[model samples]
Target: MYQVSNGIGFYVLATYFLAAIESKFLRAIPYEIELIPQEEYRSKFCYSVAECRASYPRAMDRGNDFFKYLLSRVVVSSVGGIPKYNVDEDTVIRYMWDVHQAAVDVGKSQLSDVSFYSSETERDFFMDFLLAVEFSVATLYRPYINSTAEFLVGFPHRPLTDQDRNVLASDVTVREKAFMSSVKFFSRTNEATGGLFLTVWKIAMTSEAGRAAGRFLIKRLLLIPSL
Candidate 1:
């Protein structure tokens, strides 16, 4: 079962990422005041063409690195051998942001370290927090979403039956490569999906309604059920 508690936590994250995306670009919408994030709302999550240009050495390498580092680090510790408590929304949000910043901070200070954050960020590299969607789905009601991600309107963009999260957890491939290792190396859904699926996200991030629809998706598809 999905953690009832992480629903709100994911919502906060979804909201932040959506807002961040909006802040990056502005588009005029029909009958809307103040350039809101999207003008033609078709909000989807599978953005980033990192998987497209596989020839680029660092195209998405950092994003994968960040995701790998974050998966285990973003956890609530169990105390006294009791079952681990559900991570509260504030804690999850704060800890994740803090960790993200910590990784980025070393770059701002120009520190020389081999930590994933510092080393990966050594040059301008990609960091697709969008992969957080994969993480969220990995723990969602439908844990096999990588194979069956139904979009807001299109046919299931990348319906794949990925049932090896447990096995992959202990494998070097997934541990080192995160979502990429999970989808790209096995089954038929290869990294090429990154090329087309990103179109879905662009449509979603184009208008206010589009953005709202996406956030609404976060609430309904992910947040509400778990909550």
Candidate 2:
């Protein structure tokens, strides 16, 4: 789920980019607001809606390269953990800005027609280019997960019976059922949810606050017998 503030930031940035494209000029800003340092901006995580709104113009003023780089890092950090990070707002905003800037820059140099959205082919190409850049940046920063061995150990080895297949194909939520089955299968051989929950629990146990939070969450999870 997107944080409300981040979502607002994304909308604001998208509008800004569209405006920049339509006008053929970047929006001018007041001279008083100082530019955020690249490293600091890259590390800054938006924790609230206000922070996201406050930071939007500052990020935009830094230009496309910095924006894109910061965005790529945010995406990487967001997906490196189990619960996943809430960085989508920042990612979407930066991504739109970068794509818009690229289109504008290319239209200036290569096309006789200055408008980027003029040609269907050009629009398609830019869309593909945007996805390609996103993939490339994500791959460059994606963290390595060391769970292959655990996954193999946890996997159900026996061939599925007709009943099992029927249950899998039923109207029930397939992904949730499959995940639950895997956890159950893993628990048959080892404690915890096929080592996944175990790993998280172990990590949580290392600190007092973590342990307290983990216990609270575990209690809540236990109340949900179906889970």
Candidate 3:
């Protein structure tokens, strides 16, 4: 039963990923925004695209080098039987800001494209880019999330199945309480859905080329839950 249910659970997640949560957001970007000459936008922004890209290399680093490096040190320096340290929450938080900055830079570059859109297009594009950047950055934390989830898998408390309810019914701990809170949070339907929908609405209403880039991003993010 465990194996079968686990297999079904994995397929459920796979079905979500095939929805292309990230790719859709990338593709949603209107072509006019992409057509903007890199040189012209960079000149106006006073920096090159290379610099912009390099600024957030940590977020782009898929090998998890930074995370692994830190985790190794923590594991090696264990105190007593415990790992002795928690994952650095700062890394994820800082990366979020870095991703947002990248979005701002990309959105700003769109203004130089004179034929990009009608009068109101620019503002809309900026919002879309901002939200899109947010969505992209959010995906970057997937690793940390996976780590946290894995930690929960082998947790002392057993599954929430009815069979184990009696075992945990009379006992509670901070860890257990925290786990319950997290489960309750995720169990809520339409939480992410409504938020993404609002983001999509913002993008659709935008008129500028930059804003269109943003809209493209939001549209993509909105597909994540469906994935």
- How many collisions per candidate? 12, 1, 13
User: Model 1 over residues 181-211: C-alpha lDDT tens digits?
Assistant: 3223221222357544545554554555665
lDDT for model 2: 0.37
What residue runs in model 3 are displaced by over 4 Å at the alpha carbon? 1-42, 45-90, 102-106, 109-114, 117-126, 132-221, 224-227
Q: For residues 16-73, could you state the per-residue lDDT of candidate 3 as single tens digits?
A: 2222222242246443221123453344222322332354333233213333334454
Better of 1 and 2 by TM-score: 1
Please report, in order, the local distance difference test score of every candidate based on alpha carbons. 0.32, 0.37, 0.37
Model 2 per-residue lDDT tens digits across residues 180-208:
44334334333334545445545555555
